[model samples]
Target chain A: MTITVAIDCMGGDHGPAVTVPAALAFVRDTPDASVVLVGQEDVLRKYVGAADLPRVTLRHASQIIGMDESPSLALRNKKDSSMRVAIDLVRHGEADACVSAGNTGALMAISRFVLKMLPGIDRPAICASLPTQSGHTHVLDLGANVDCSPEHLLQFGIMGASLVGAIEHNDRPTVGILNIGEEEIKGNDVVKRAADLLRDSGLNFIGNVEGDGLYKGEAEVVVCDGFVGNVALKTSEGLAQMLAFFLRQEFGRNMLTRLIAVLALPVLKRFKNRLDHRRYNGACLLGLKGIVVKSHGSADAFSYGFAIARAADAVRTGVLARIAERVAQGQTQPEPA
Target chain B: MTITVAIDCMGGDHGPAVTVPAALAFVRDTPDASVVLVGQEDVLRKYVGAADLPRVTLRHASQIIGMDESPSLALRNKKDSSMRVAIDLVRHGEADACVSAGNTGALMAISRFVLKMLPGIDRPAICASLPTQSGHTHVLDLGANVDCSPEHLLQFGIMGASLVGAIEHNDRPTVGILNIGEEEIKGNDVVKRAADLLRDSGLNFIGNVEGDGLYKGEAEVVVCDGFVGNVALKTSEGLAQMLAFFLRQEFGRNMLTRLIAVLALPVLKRFKNRLDHRRYNGACLLGLKGIVVKSHGSADAFSYGFAIARAADAVRTGVLARIAERVAQGQTQPEPA
Candidate 1:
């Protein structure tokens, strides 16, 4: 099946300078994939090569959304924005999925308004893959639903499990709730009630997984309220940046240490490549009627390609269909008391 | 005045093996500080040296609290446990403060029951200093009150600011509410309301701080509900561990890299020392009428010594009095609408 992904070429820090080239490279590399570059026609035209015309299509979008623009304001004002146009393609079935390196709040808000939500799903969650010791773990509600109910968390668990099952080809993925402790008695009222519902949800519930366990790859899918998940995700980023700074400072302290840094450069580079955040750039807006993936706002061409690839993978693997089916099945099951 | 800190010598993973020696070393090094070791007499006697006797006192407690025991059960059943005895020492004026490396929940419950809350403060918060780019930032409610009201968060800000003021000698520390975004509209209802309350508060209230801002040292004190704080802390720990593991794995990949690892050992060691968790081992249990500090359960002697020193610092700086004064002042001021 040929998967077509819509790209918001005018979004993110670099605009078409990063997105257009990323889209061209994506279609060139993936034989079974095509891309629609959505932005102002005159601006994006300069970035696309004439040789790549067969698989690349240019769709005009007159307006642009600022990285710091309010989500609600952008939704109401920028009707023809690259971000909105990209999602509109997915809604109109012109594209199988959409990828944008834009403001996360704006992307989420626009996608939800355009694509709507899947049946039986009360809210859309921002699900993203994070690097772990074993491999990677998919955590949901990164910043989409700040306040989530027990039933919403249950839906997240179901949607997350379905996403993992579809993408990893694993029939049964281990699902766990992120909590302060592994014990059932731990956490607040919402977390405790969510745990009870998940226990009887018929998924491969692995009980509570602590914050550290997320990196340990203790579960395939970790569910949390957006408030907690967003903090966890951003905290990890801040810590990684600080550690890198410390390493540089230590290595550059004096003449002897500087020599040692040169000798160890290859190993350090390899270590960095193994845990590169660029490899995990795409974040899925789960539970939407159509697929929309968000890339980091500061992502460059190389990292943006990963986000486009992720959207294509979702389309090829039928992740949206899988999630819809799971939610439908969950609605039939009696609610957990 | 000489500060006296009661030590729970029979607590933590290593029990007397780690805690007793740490207490002895602490008193030996600190000229104006003494420790009253609370534990089984037989277990702690072997660890204390003759030279440490002048500044150390052994106060025998017959029972012990297991590390994984339920908090309520431990609080009610283990009245004679070393953990309880240490808090009891502070409550009865036998010691100016107390330090424990026991189960956190048990310590909080026992401390609250014994010392009671300071006037106008609803609950205790776990405040700990984390390594940041500039120095360190003190984050509070790490795991004490998982679900916090806006008023509870406002109280936490007051208490955290007071603690920083006492310890760091900074009377007007900048405080920020932890949120997913820096915008006023970001986060759930509690955090938004808390930000409003903080703005109207008498303290130096900076606006919303993102997760990454915590390590950036954007604010001196970052206040959040216990659930978010706990997850952020543990998530940082997990990421740090993973990075360390990846570094080791890469360095030991082959004979050439192994040789390079030897050359890079000094630089690597210095980097490790700069970010050592031992230097930040103690978490202050704030809002209690008396000062109580908690050490990491898996801390070694060197790390546990920091917790003892922290308790001494708290007592000498009169942190409890500072918090009481701040809360009382807050009560007199009109509540934020």
Candidate 2:
């Protein structure tokens, strides 16, 4: 089946400069995919030209939201903004999914208001992919609901497992709740309660997994409250950036070291290519009625392109449909006595 | 004045094999330091000869706490265990501080039971130093308390600031609360309330910092609840290890790449040293009545040596005294109207 994705052309730091090129590259790679670019008509036309661009359509919108805009303020005001317009396209069935690299708070708020929540889901979670020694692991609630209840965490587990199962073609995915320690009695009240609920939730629930478990491939899906997940994700990025900075400084310390650096350039390039974050840039805003993918605000063409691909992949794999089916089945399950 | 440190010789994964050599190296490096090695007599004597060891004295203890034992079981049952006995030496004023590489829960549980909390401090925090781009940033509550109230976080800032001020020779060290975002209205209720307290508590409070703030050197001491801090710390470690693994895998891929790896060996060594967590291995159990430094359970001889040096440094710098003074002074301040 042909897949269509709505692109927020005026979102993020570089806006159309980044989004336009990424959209072109994405559609070029997918034979049966098209993109609906949302932004100001005059401004977007400057980039796309008057000629018929292959598999691309431009939709006009009046307002633009700043990267640092207040989410509530942007919500009440900017109904015609590119971000809102893109999500609206999905709601209207003009596109199967929408991808935006904008203010995260603004994007989530607008998407929730426009698309609403799926059945049996109180709040949507931010689901992202991280690299592991064995392969890849999916983590949810990266920053959407900062103060998640135990119930919210359990719902996140279901949504995350569904997303992975749909996209990765794994029928039964292992779910692990993230905690401070691996023991049964290690976590705070929320995690402990969530663990109890998960144990009886009828899913393939493993016990508690610590922070290292995410990278060690202990489970396919790791669930945590948004506050903890955001900190973990950011810390990993910070540490990786620091290591790269130090490596550059060490290589440039002296003339001999610089010569060694020249000889080691190929190896360093290969190493960097293998760990390049752009390859894992896209993250789905799960539990929403329609598919919404949030790209890194500072993502370049490469990462933004991957985000476009991610939106199509989610649509093609029917991730949102699978989550809806599971939630429906969960509602029919007997309530705990 | 000479500082005598109590060393838990039977603690950690390697037990006496790691701690014994580390204690000797520590004494050799410090001019006015002595150690009381506490463990089983036979096991301790195997590592340390029957002859008199310079600046090292063996104190026989009959029990050893397993790494996976229940904290309460170890605390209530094993009073004369190596970890507990070492802390007792400090409690009785026979040693200035204690160092252990044992199970963290057991260490914190035992230490709190032996050395009560300082006045006005409801809980003790685990404070660890992390490698940052500028140099190093200190982060607290790494795994001590999983659940924390707003008041506890405010107290953590006070204690963390005091520790950094005393040890780093800065009278007023900057303190940053870790949160999901930098905005004033961006975090959970607990963090928002804690921010309010920090604003008027008279500390050098900068605004909230995201995870990247720890590595960017935004603050000298980063404060958070133990759960969030532990996740951040462990995620950093896991990411670093994964990057290292990828680098190794890339370098050994082919013969030409392996030759480039041989040339880049010196640069690689410096990179490892700069980002080495061992250099910043020791973490303080702050707000305690006396100093207690906790080393990594898997720490090698060099890291264990650093832990010993950390205990002595905390004693010499009067870290406990400073925290006590701040806590007492804080009690005199009137509650918010």
Candidate 3:
């Protein structure tokens, strides 16, 4: 199966400098995959180089959305934006999937507006893989729906499970509700109701998992409302950044510590590599009719390639089909309000 | 003023083995402070030694509350538990504050039931200081109230500011609402309403703060519903543990790395010291008529002593009086339902 991904080359902090190279590298690495680099032809052409790679193609897009632009404004005004054009490619079935390192809100809004929601899905959710002790766990609704209902949470569980089933090739991934405690009596009314719905659902429902369970790999897929998930995700980022800063400050404190840092550089580098955030760069915008993955807006070429690879994997593994099928089976029926 | 803190000696994972030593060490370090150890008198006497320290005393309690017991069950049945007796001492004016390394739910429930809420406050909150880039930021409502109103959040902001004022001596500490973003339009309705209330609150309101801003030290105090706060705190712990595990695994991968690890041990130890979780062990149960601090159940003597110091500091600085005065001033009037 030849998986083609539409790349928003003009998006992200580095624009074409990061996205174009990442696209070329992705195509070079995967013989069964191709990428359509969508951006201002003039700018992207300069980075595309003299060697004409058959697997890599360029599509012209006149407008570019700023990283900090309002999502609504970008969705309404920037029709020819690389982000929109990339999603348009997926909508028209020109590409199997779309990937962008653009503004998350804008990408989400534009994707929803263009490709529309998948059948039986109310709102699309942002799903991303987080590094864990055993391997990694997929967490959904990182920042999509701030106020989610129990039905929405139930939907997130189904979509998340389908995502793991497709990507990890696991038919029944352990799904858990993100709560304050693992007990049934824990959490607010919505979570309690969602737990009931999940328990009845045919998926491998593991009940409630605490915050620490996310990194402990207690479940293959952890589902939460966007507000909670976003806070958890960003808080982790903040902590990791603070720890890194402290590590650098301590190692550079004095001459004696500096000497030890020099000797320990190799081991430190290896350790850093094992926990590299780049390895988990792509965040899948799940529950959409077509596959859409959002890369970090500040991602570099090497990091952005992971996003491309994720989009390709979703396409090849038929994640969208699995979600539709799961929902169609009527296993995720919500309780009447 | 000499402050008196009642210690729940039978609480925590180690019971008297940890709490007894911690109480003794606390009185030794804090000359102006005294501790009344509440637990099985015979069991604690064995650990208290024959010194008969002038500042240390023992109060016998027949029962012990299990760490895993339900909060409501412990509150009703374990009224004679060491946890209850310690709080009772504070209620009876024998002690100015109380410290416990016990079940957090039980501590909060029992504290609220015994000490009661301060005038004009509906519910209590759990406030704890987290290490940040510049210094530290105090966050409140960490698993106390899973669901909170805008009014409750405003109360939390007020209480957190008061705690910071008492502990850090900052009367006008920058206060912020924890949200997915720093923008006015970010977060759920409660957060948005809370932001508006905070703006008119006559306090040092700094508007919305993102998760990364917590570690960046953008605000001295950040307030949120207990659900969000607890998830953020526990998620950070999980990530830190995972990173530590990864670091150890990388260093022990091969003999060459092991030699480098030995050479770099001192620097690594210093780095670890700067990021020690034990340094921020105590969490203040704010909005109560009396001061109560909860220590980590797994804390050692040195770590648990911090909780004792926290309670003593709260008493010495008159944190309870400050919060009551602030609330009595009618600065936190909630909107009618």
Tens-digit per-residue lDDT, B258-312, candidate 1: 9999989888998999889998999999999998999999999999999989989
Whole-model lDDT per candidate = 0.91, 0.90, 0.91
Clashing pairs in 1: none
Show the lowest summed lDDT stretch of 10 residues, model 3 chain A: A328-337
TM-score per candidate: 0.97, 0.97, 0.96
Q: On residues B1-337, what C-alpha lDDT tens digit does candidate 2 reach at each position?
A: 8999999999999999999999988888898999999999898888888898788889999999999998899999999899999999989998999999998889989989999999889898999988889988889889899888989998999899889889999877888999999888888998999888888888888979899889999999888999999999888888888888988988898998888888888889878988888988899999889999999999999989988898999999999889888888882333335
Candidate 3 CAPRI assessment class: high
Q: Cα deviation in Å at residue A239, candidate 2?
A: 0.6
User: lDDT tens digits, residues B35-132, model 3?
Assistant: 99999999998999756888899999999999889999999999899999999999999999999999989999999999999988999899999999
Q: Which ten residues in a row have the lowest lDDT in candidate 2 chain A?
A: A328-337
Residue pairs with backbone overlap in model 3: none
Error of 3 at B245 (Å): 1.1
Instruction: Give a tens-digit lDDT track for model 3, residues A243-282.
Output: 9898899889899889988988888888788778898899
